[model samples]
Target: MVEPLPHVREIPPYVPGKPPPARPGLTSYKLSSNENPYPPLPGVLAAAEQAVASMNRYPDMGCALLYDALAAKLGVQVDQLAAGTGSVALIYHLLSAYCGPGDEVVHAWRSFEAYPIAVTAAGAAGVKVPVTADGRHDLDAMAAAITERTKVVLVCTPNNPTGPALTHAEVATFVAAVPAHVVVVVDEAYLEFVRMADPVDGLALVRDHANVVLLRTFSKAYGLAGLRVGYAVAAPEIAGALRAVALPFGVSSVAQAAAVASLAAEDELLARVDGLVAERARMVAGITAAGWWVPEPQGNFVWLGVGDRAAELAAAAGDVGLALRPFAGEGVRVSVGEAEATDRLLHLLGSLEPPS
Candidate 1:
């Protein structure tokens, strides 16, 4: 009989949002995952196709061209950047690099579900600081919770599940208070979708704080989710440490080509993000008018804090053939999808008589 480690036994597996089935109906649209409802840009697709032709040869292990491109785009030294299969993978790498038994990683509870899983996987204790009642990070509480054992602090602006984002001033205050030795990762997967005034810029924080790292992804705004590519920008030493633990050739040639192309076509891609931002605003305004009090969402998703009624809300959504992300006993998260999908969800939501 095999005995798994005690920490391994305590870890909960990460659960992804339900996938939409291929049902032929208007109500069957999937709003479960916070995925962009658009396809890859034409130039990006062409680049990916071109790379596929070279499948016979191995991808560049050093990712030299990608480094150069990112450096030129970001105006940072090439040594300050590191690429991974996904931002999720980069998170895991960060955990593995800095955490071990007896160490602790701090992050907001009910934030990204991956945080706890990755922390436990690294044999570290997860210190979950609960968010404020309005679904924003309780920064002061988090700063107070920090101890000598804390190795990392994860701040997810435009946080998942519940969509309130940290303002630039809010983030600045938190970073200034954190210890210099502790790594602070600002996960900006949904950064491009943010429309708030004075939004936190992770890149700016990274430039100012030696221990700060910015985790950005192609999966969200760039619409390269299928290709699985993300990157981190940090001090050269931290970037080197991350690269040290990363799996070799994890960023495939195809993914690299697609990412470079996406960067080249970023202006047009961001215009599509503007459309999603509008859709999110529509969802919020439409639902608020229906008497529901939702936290103002800055990401491409909306949160319904149904509390213990989570399962019921999810089931009701399912009845309409709408797949929503529901956190049982907590709340529901519905993404802004295609126009028809948005119409169906908003119509269903508006028809309900809930407390303001």
Candidate 2:
């Protein structure tokens, strides 16, 4: 019998959010994946289409043009960047480069599910610090969890599943307290949606700290979820290590073209984010007036702490041909979709009876 490694056997598979269920007559909306509801911005789709002609050729392994453009935009050196299939892929690459058996990766519990998956795959022990009551990272606890065995510390601002973000002062304090040897990865996957007061500037943190890495993706705000592409901004040495583990030709030419176009159309694309922000506020307001307790959301999604009724809560949304993300007994994450989805969800979610 072929047996896998112990760590490999232990890892729970990474499950992408369930797709929108079929509705015979009524229009259904999927608010499960925290996906940006909008389509590609002007020029973005066209750039992607144009790149189709080059499908016969392999993608630029170094991602030269993308690096040049992103470097100029983020005000970072080209060598300080490494593109990957997605930020999650980059997360895995980070672990692959730095972690092995007996090493540890520190992150918050009930945060991004990908963190634990990657750590397990790398044969690294995961130290999961629980979040505060309101769905915010307990930075103090995370710092306390660190030890000589810790190789990476992941900070997910505007934390997934539950959408509260960390303030600048909070992250600064945590960053200062953490040791220099451990790589602190600030995953800013949905930072474009954050509008909280005193927001953490991830790039600035990376610029100042040699051990800091800011992992961001075009999947959310850029509306490029279908075409996988994300990048890490870090000190050249760290960036080089990430590149060392990256799958060659991992980022396709189409994705590269689309990302460059999205940057060129940044103003217009961000305007769409403004619309989503407004919709998010509307979602929070509607959910609150109905009597359920939800944490203030800074991302393009809202988290309902449904606890044991998570499946029941998701079923209620499903009844209206709307799909939501449920973490069993934890909570439900509803993405900010079109106005109708929000309107219907508010009306339906309030009516869901708690499961005994």
Candidate 3:
């Protein structure tokens, strides 16, 4: 067998959230992945269907329509935008463009799981700084971790699994502290769900700092995870570099149309986001009321830091026909899904003895 690179041998596999197991009588809910529980709106569905008619032909390689729509919505020049299969793919593109053997990418540990995978695949070293006790990024430590070998730094706001978001002041300070040569990627996959004051303004960061890049997606908030449409906003030079390294025709026609339609109907789509945010609030309130300390969740999910009992609680949820994502000895991440899921989760957590 042809030998693969030594780094590839050490890459940890990404464990995605599992589907809910069948229950004979009870309805099962999948609160494992932080996915939008709602189905796509009619207009978005129709757009995707229409695009399907052109399946025999290839999609617009440049993603012209999607770029126009995003430019109008984001007020950024089209030259600054680069779309890919998903934000995860964009991460790969960025790393591939800027990193090579012996280079370093700094990010918080327990952040979006793909960070390490993408970094390794790019032949770059990953420098992981641990999150604070509250599950928020230790921005200062992340800054301190940077060195001459560092090429990229990722900051996932309203971070996945553990759900605390960075404020504008926090991100701004961190950006100032980072060297001008390092790329600061602000991943905002759950931006629409954020209700916190002083949220990190990714656009402002991208505008003010040439080294800053913003990654956003339609997966979580727009219910287009299956279609895999994500984009990056950065300085024209960096965005061009990403586009240069992108896989041709990555964003499918159906996905592009659906994304454009979703953007056109932003207000209505965001109304659904509002409902999910309410459900998140209820979940947080119930968990805290039960005496369990949950990180202040700004995304469409909550984190249960049950320590060694993480797997136990996750198994308990499974037995009740609910699927939640658990990180072995760390904690369980429960998405704020349907109201029924929230009720079931609250009941399950409420019944258990709160973690000491």
Candidate 4:
């Protein structure tokens, strides 16, 4: 038997959400993964059905139609877009193409779980920059951590577990200070949920900085997580590099078709985004009023810094048939679902009264 590479041995496996157990007479609300509780829009469903006629053939290896459609929507050239199974896959491709054994990749700890995984899979050194006291990226410190050995750096805006996004000026400062040789990725997984006046415009930065790559997904606002279609907007050269490392026909024809159709229904999707924002506001308001510690999360989820009471709160929530994701040492990350589910979660929190 062949021994695994040293790098592979050192890598830790990813810990994903665990499904709540099926308890007798208890109905569970799954708000673990940050998914849209809403179903796919009618137009997207129709497009998927239409594309099912030709599953016999392989997907378009070039993803020409999908690239063209996204380019038109994003106002970028076709060559500047590269489609992936998901934005996370694009992240992996970027790391594989730009990073190696001796290189260093820096990202905020507890941001996106995939960042470290991708960096290590590429045989690169993973440098974790801690989040600020309030759970936002420390951009100045991240920039300071950079060195000649750093090949790439990731900025997860509206960060996953704790979600306060960086401002435009802050992003500009960090981007400008980084060395030209290091690739910078702005993982805007929850960009649409941001309603603040001056949230950083990642696409604009992509247009201005050739070294920067903007990653987005249909999984979030588009309600197409099952479709697994996401894309990266970057310079043509960088897009080409991603394509080179990406597995052939990485995105399915159906996924491409569905994404194109979803783009056409942008108005409807935006409306759903508004609904999530409203729901999130309600969730935060309810939790804060109830006197449990909750962060002002900009993402679709809410963070409760449970501290030592983390397990107890999670257990209490479970007893009431609400499924939440506990981030081990960190707090619990609860996704905002539909009205009914959100109401149920609020009711659960109120009833629990986890000790401070």
- Among all candidates shown, the one with the greatest lDDT: 3
Instruction: Write down the worst ten-residue block by lDDT for model 4.
Output: 15-24
For model 4, how does the per-residue alpha-carbon lDDT over 1-356 read when each residue is reduced to its tens digit?
A: 89987888877788776666566786677778898889888889989888888999888989888888888888899889888998999999999999899999989977898888888889999989999878889988899899899999999999998878888889988999988878999999899999786899888898778899999999998988988989999999999999999999889989989989888999999998999999999998988877776656888998887767667767777776777888776788899987877787788778776446
* Model 4 spans > 4 angstroms off: 23-26, 353-356
Clashing pairs in 3: none
Ranking by TM-score: 3, 2, 1, 4
Candidate 3: residue 58 lDDT (0-100): 97
TM-score of 1: 0.97
Local accuracy of candidate 1 as per-residue lDDT tens digits, 1-356? 99998899988988788876455554487788788889888899999999999999999988888888889998899899999998999999999999999999999988999999999999999999998888988999999989999999999988998999999999999999999999999999999999879998777898899999999999989988888899999999999999999999999999999999998998999999999999888888888887787887988899899888887877777777788998988899999888877777778877776743
> Please, what's the RMSD in Å of model 3?
0.7
Output the number of the TM-score-best candidate: 3
RMSD of each candidate? 1.4, 1.3, 0.7, 1.4
Candidate 2: regions farther than 4 A off = 353-356
Candidate 2 lDDT by residue in tens digits, 1-356: 99999899999888677877778887899999989888887589999999998899999999999999999999999999999988999999999999999999999989999899999999999999998889999999999999999999999998997899999888888988989999999999999999988999988798778989999999999999999999999999999999999988999999999999999999999999999999998888877787777888888898888788888878877877998999988988999989988899889956765323
Error (Å) of candidate 4 at residue 261 is: 0.5
lDDT-wise, the better of 2 and 3 is: 3
**Each candidate's TM vs. the true structure?**
0.97, 0.98, 0.99, 0.96
